[model samples]
Target: MNFEYMKNFMDSLTEWIIPGNSVVIYKDGKKVFEYSSGYSDLEKKIKKTGEEQLYIYSCSKVATVTAALQLYEQGKFLLSDPLYEYLPEFKKMYVKDGDRIKAAENPITIRDLFTMTAGLSYATNTPAFEKARKLTDGKMDTRTVIKCLAEEPLLFEPGARWNYSLCHDVLAVLAEVVSGMRFSEYMKKNIFEPLDMNNSYYHTPNDVIISPQYIYEIQDTKNIVELQQKEHTTGVVKRAYGNELVFGENYDSGGAGIITTVDDYAKFAAALANSGTGLNNNRILSSATVKLMKTNQLNEAQRKTMNWRRLRGYGYGLGVRTLIDKAESGSNSSIGEIGWGGAAGATIIADTEEKVALFYAHHMLNPQEEYYQPRLRNVLYSCL
Candidate 1:
């Protein structure tokens, strides 16, 4: 394995991605690679340690979905179960055709949300979604947001297409209602503590000051300008008020929110890669459930509908995306590799067939500059 390329890739990341941080890679249940560079607090000139937690963004979706699957395994819910059963507000949802809000002939199911085919989009260019945003207005709080979503019409019929929307937010609330506990509490009890992911949480306390997020913005001609050295004030940040924001507020958003460190998250990913075995030989999930979760649930046309890079022939599983074609992925990813990333640039990739897992976390949201997902994946696979 030519690790020189990986080292180069990690070094180059400082120029393109997070200024300084740490990365950890595991193979066959061992830490095969680790690197730390730059500083966690650039202003204070504090070098980044191996233990600082990073905002694991949408990567939290995997944890929330895993909790949902646990409930499913306990016969609390089913894939085919109409989602509206647990969240009745989702019932009577309709679609916007021209000027009218026509009722959807079918109800959106839990499977629809998992498969990204529920016709429920998030911050996308759909008439209904646009209207939904306006309806919710500044009240993006947990209860008001979902109420707005329930009132809005679906963009397409259930199972008609795939779009990355706020489906996970809805999932978070669903987990709460069905499990009879708040979403955060449910995760802490079932997923976090069980897996010893003690460093993971949704919010950062005021006293726990770290360097606020910073990024480069392209200015005139070729000059790149430094954006505001401020914390990201979207989604969870806005709701980080009241009731000690160290834990997430009421915005039970399953898609994003989990905060974790390189070590704790690596253990979680290793468990998924190791057929659900965690610390002390405790199995967080059965091998059967994990296998089922990795299976592709999209068909040919559905696969064609997904337009994102690295997702050409991918399908959504219970939580992770399932790869159906390596050639289409245009990377060295295995046929059965499953994983996803967070909005803040945190990423986790697991190749169950190959028994490998990769975890990287940084805080950059420029989706255009091309992060190290495929590059690192190819490098890791080439090592094998």
Candidate 2:
């Protein structure tokens, strides 16, 4: 494969857009190509070693879905089963009307959480979270916080459409409840342990130093400029969020909370690409289950809500976006190619059809994904 063009594109990105980026690609469960471009500490001139811990934000959902599916494979729950079956607090949900809220017409199903059709919103500053904070004494544990979320009104009836919300976080609680383990504990024993992903974590270990995170603003109409950490008001220095999505010590944000390195997380991506088996020959899921993981779960009406520009030719899968239309996307990716990106430039590409996996990230927040994601996928396919 000719990876020269892809490498050059990455180098160009480090020069102008974000400070630095790293990528690890695998084919058939073996590392094929790896590169780290630019610097990790731009101020200190420290290069990206491909070992620095990065907060993968929404990319955590990929792992979350994989974890929950293990339970599915074990016959712990069915996709169509009501979420209330596992977490009884959801038995009586409410939906928001114009200025009033009323009980929801339909119950939320496990399928709704996987497909992001649960009608939940990304809003976190509601009274529900506040109540949860008080109840947990600021710990904001998974079960208590998620249960409090049920008191908040949903945007619509469950399963009516797709909405990117805290559904995966609730799925984390599902894993915790059914497996009788904390979300973090369940992931470590099931995912990290099996795949040999030693560096990934739900909390930043005090010993490991994380990469410096940054946020940028538009300098001119077309140029982007970096803001010093002290000058920035939005970014949380070196992490994805402080308490926005990841609540506290006890909370495990399956939706947007994962701290990992490119080299480590790529192993998980490679497992998906290699049909649920790791490079070390550990099988994380059955091949059939991996296929279901990437299959498009959205219908025509539900797809209308996934209007992100970067997802032009894709459909929402269990958690990731699966390629559905090549001509519409102008992409060279395989038909069932699936993956997702983070708010801070982390990207995952899992093409089980071709046995190819790629994980990439730039240590910057508010990653302009629209410009790079589709192009990067298209370029990777061209290299192959």
Best by lDDT: 2
lDDT of 2: 0.87
Tens-place lDDT per residue, model 1, 187-273, is: 888888888887877555555543344443333222212222222221111112222111224455677777678878987888788
The lDDT values for all models are 0.69, 0.87
Give the least accurate 10-residue stretch of model 1, judged by summed lDDT: 236-245
**In candidate 1, which residue pairs clash?**
122-165
- Residue 80 deviation, candidate 1, in Å? 0.6
TM-score of each: 0.84, 0.94
Which pairs clash (backbone N, Cα, C closer than 3 Å) in model 2? none
Candidate 2's residue-wise lDDT over 205-290, tens digit each?
88987788876543433322333222323332344444356888888999988999999999999999988999889998999998
**How far is each candidate from the true structure, as Cα RMSD in Å?**
5.6, 3.3
Quality of model 1 by C-alpha lDDT:
0.69
